[model samples]
Target: MHYLFWCKDNNTSTPQDMCWVSLRMREQHFPGHVLCWVSMRMRDHLFPSPWQRHDALRAEVGAQAGAADTARETSTALYPLIVRQGMDKYKVLEEWRAGSFGATCIVKEAVGDGRRFAVKKVECIDEHEANLALKEAMVLLNLQHPNICAYKEFFITWDNTISSLFLSLVMDVSDQGDLGGIVRLKRQLVKKMDETVIQMLLGQAIDVLVYIHKQKVLHRNLKPSNILLKDEDSFLLSDFVVETLAADEMKLKIRMDDECKLWMAPEALQFSYSEKSDVWSLGCVLLDMMTCSITNDAEVAALLQEIRLDPVCLENVLKTLVGKVGYSADLCQVLLQMLQIHPVQRATAIELMDVPYVKECLILVGSPLSGVKKTLPPGVSDELYEGGIEKALEFMQIYTDFEDAQISALRHLSWYIADQDGWLCIEEIIRLVVQAMKLHSDSLDIQLEGIWILRDLVSQALAHGLNEECFISNELITTLVRGMRSFLPNTGLLSQICSLMMMLSANEVAAELLGKAGVLQDTLKIMESSLENRELCLSCCGLLWSMAMTESHTRREWLVYAVPVIFNLVLKHLHDGQLVESACCSLWILCLKGCVVEEQTESISWALLESLHAHPQRPVLVKNACLALASLLRTSELAAFRVLVPVSGKNGIALIKEIYHLHSDDPEIVENMCLLFSEMAHYGDTRPEMLSQNMGPFMREIKVKFASTEEIVTLAESTLSKLET
Candidate 1:
């Protein structure tokens, strides 16, 4: 059979040199527009349709035939032109086409049972051209994936170092011809294919990447046109023009095309790529799959700008995709997790295997392993249908049949309990939280919810006078730590963990575990970097204050690190009343214990006394400062005592005057001030003389206003008696 398969290179112009090859076509009909590819190697031309074996060969066969005579002469020089039938199947095929990547015959020979097999002759113009073909052939032969075109055999005609490859033949045309042609023929069908079938094809492409990674290879040239889909199951991960050692290759083959760059990962554009980096490109594939509506730079740029501005809202994008595609929420969740910004955070093929929806494929193959059991506390029950803790636990289950319904119900319940300020539900809420923690042990959201529930429980326990030690355990600490480290870096959950640990400081065993867990360092490090993160800083201050207030013997050593940091933080962010109050409270606790540090006592004491003088907005600050001063005078006869005494007196007088002029209605302030001065007189060794001087005028003012401020006046009289003594 003779055939003229005309094809233009579109990029190259050698129309006069187009090959018209003759070959046996006894089995298959030669349909117009149906590409019949013929390769010299049986394996290259006869494997499968996805191989595009016949099509690729046909395209090459129609390329430059003017240089074909040169290729034929070279092939004849390398080996004798033998035309044996079955005995020379390999030899005759090589003789026909030599010194080329592989050529296409318009009428390709089908490897049918006992037919007249004929090889179409073809060639390349030069050795350089031939080497390009060899390189492509070697790469094709090396490649192995479900989506890739399979390479079968290579022919070296014993003529003149001429070579050709035989590959598995694909469809005559395409699913609807080339992508450009398909884009024109069936716009809606192609869009639907892009939405469904193409996703599977891209998934196959990613799977190919996973395989390449396993083999330590990289398919650096990845683009949509290279991704060919024939059907749901039949797809091709083709076009391996650039191959390199994934680890060793630093340089990449640059393409002039603009569309390919759109799907490339930022790291890939920079040429610093790894297997995980390919996962970023895969994420682009996923995003393309999710939103088939956008294809151009303007749309992509707009979407990316939105993503960049508020990356946390990526879940919303996934939710939108769910609205469009009617995909499972769990599947969307898996894809979103895979697209996480950090390469380390993105899912590998094996890690993707863990996603519940991804595991559905494995489930079809065999039954899934049961969800692993996590330890739950004794009071917590697992019976979801029963009453008590069991019934309450249903509110916290994240992915049950009633998860969406429970979210609304749980939100309402949480609000109702908090608004009413009911403390009775504390135990019940805690048990539900524990059960939730067990149910969604692997979920970040559930663990975060558990922490939040624990916070509410702590506040409720304190309000209801429940024992603080009741919640402390190895189990609680382990849960908190696991959740903290489970997500990389900080998830803004450390503050809650520190707050929970602070509540546990009243317990000896839990406090020790917290301290030994390097909880102190964690809090301090956060404080160091988190000076601007108000909530985190405040929580750190609170934790430090609790640690100091525990009254343990080891408090002094921790104070060496905690005290200075707390002081600097107070000075920097004094506008925050909670921070100020917490700083003063911490100072009060440290001073109440009277830590004896000979080297740093004077400076620490002066700083404390000055903080009292500089910030007098809250009475709690003054009261604690006075207590710290009194404790210092009582415990240490060092320079701190002498330095802190007169400073405390001046601060006290300043505070009293502020109260007298501004907050005179606050009788508690005047009463606490009088008591503070009285305590200083009896307990302070260095402040008696200064107190004696201030006591006269303070009493005189109180005496004149005795009727209006009788409680303060009475306290002042008592303080006067102490001063006289």
Candidate 2:
């Protein structure tokens, strides 16, 4: 049935403009032009050609659209031979599943029933090639079991070359949709399923596995999607394309699909498989069912270890076999034994069936006996076996995917909004993360995540927002300080913690709390470290700044003990521009209280002033140095003006003159400088002898810049006038 197509125009606004296709069918030689308009919204506003519009279905389905219905209508071309052999008599319905293997439906009369039955066909090949439906029909006919799907028939009779098949359909017994959907629904309806119901459903699955294995068959791909429950109790297994013959059976020449081989047993994955191999696959399926969602391999391994060690908490069992279907710890033990990597030691299906609890399940969860046909509900498709993790990850990795471990860790600590129950969840999550870390402490992912979680814990406690009581006062400080040293090279984590401390330690009460908590010394060591993370170092400086400037005199004394380290850092980095800026800010924070005469202020100023003259390129260093000296001179009440000359080394007055000149517009800097001058004026007034030596050059520079500087600058200039007035 060949057809020729021509062009048409489009009206809708989309990337592919509307393309009208003219068609001529070979059967009747009927000629007609169908308007198969592509979207008017091209890449931005241009239209794609007719062929491109037809090929974009896969991309368009997942994308957001406004004119999808119209686009679907415009793209349906008869020239593509819409009606093939077995499907010619049927009227095409809308698409059923737009999954990796596309499946569409049509209404066709049943051969035996002579009534209309919905026919679904999956196609991944050209119209001339055989479709997945044909292969599926051939594969399903060979299976024979009570819990397994029964093949009704196959259809592909056509005089012409077009060939398609139809077969019996299985009901979509997905709990909600997929496993994620089931988990979400369970969260909403957790109280609905009694312990008995859970046991029944799980037991039914076990029975289905047993029945499947007894037929000398290995359902290599056993998963949640393969196990469907009708009315939440009757479980049936379906969809077997990669089934393998038992190991002891005579070899059969069967074609295998390498792509679907991942779900096979580890031994089978490397070699041939036996019916016991199916048991290992069943273990993975059970893990998915219990977790209610798929997990990464690492998490799966972790959960398996926990279950092996303490199966009672992680794996529950049924005490009584009420119906015939039931659970017991012995059943789990048997299943675990079958999943052993050494196939020789693994329990055979016959051996597993003889277990007492297995016998109980067979009688309790009796298999369904009816062969009635049931129409599957909408929204479910047979594409459930997309791929095992390796394939999924391989597919996703061809592009790029991203996640942040830190954010994941912090969010793990989030609390519930109303009852503050989220704190308990956070507590459990932290313990899990910490345990995982203890097992793999060298793991960068775990360390990064742990640091962020600790930071959030501290922040949340200070905010008094989340009701989670995961952290005691001392525990919070201990966790944070330990994270700082352990998570090396992650300056972002360090800075984040430092910023959190700056906010939490701002109040005197919090600082006192932190000091007794033993974080104060660790924080001082971090501040004095020779590391080069300026932002993180500055954050440490900010915390100390908060502490020293805090109102508590006792806290101020603790800060004073660390002053020598601070003073040394200022001298060492006085020449390096970036470090100088940090050192200056630290010095400003430290000098909140005026230096006392008996304090080390005199020696500190001498050292800082010498560095300022030597590192002239560091303007910020000189600026802060002048400010610190001004603060100290003011502390002396102008009595220490005599030290200015020796400390400046002839350039000190010039630096001070420049500091006053450039920052004169800033009130704070100008006011501090004026205080220095006013104090010096008092010294000159008390003993006019000191003024004669150094006042000439300093007085001239002050006089020249007085009017241009500030009124306070002039007042300080006139205060020098008071000394000689």
**Whole-model Cα lDDT per candidate?**
0.50, 0.46
lDDT of 1 by residue, 1-725 (tens): 22222233335433333333443322123211112222121133242331133233334423423224443544521111112221233222233322111233222334444232223222333333333434344434434334564443333232222332122212122232233334333333435234444434434554566555765655555554445555634556544432222211222232123455555555555556666656665565556555544334356545643553356767777776678656567756766765666666667765665556655533332211223333334433333334433344454553332223333334444555555553555655655555445334455556665677677767777877876556655446545655554543453677777787777665656665565445666677668767777777777778887665432213245666666777677768766766777777776555554443556566656665566556666667765665555445445555434443566456434444554555455555555455555445554453465464566676667656655665556657766676666
Best by TM-score: 1
Mind giving the per-residue lDDT tens digits that candidate 2 earns over 1-725?
A: 32333232323323244333334434223122111111112131132321122123212322312233333454422213222244444444446643212233435443555334334333222222232334333434434333554444344222223332122232222232333235345534532224344445445656566555544445655655455544445555654433222221222113233323434566665557677777766655554344422344445445544443353534342222122223345655655665566678667655766666555555566432111212333432222235332232232233111123222322333322122433334454445444333323334565566555545555555566653334434234434544555664667776776776666565434564455444445556776774455676667766665555432212334555566766676666555566655556556445434322345766666655666555655556555555555555545633354345555456444555555556655554554455545555555433354354455455555556555645445546655675666
Find the 10 residues in a row with the least total lDDT in model 1. 77-86
- Quickly count the clashes in candidate 2: 24
TM-score, per-candidate, Cα-based = 0.39, 0.35
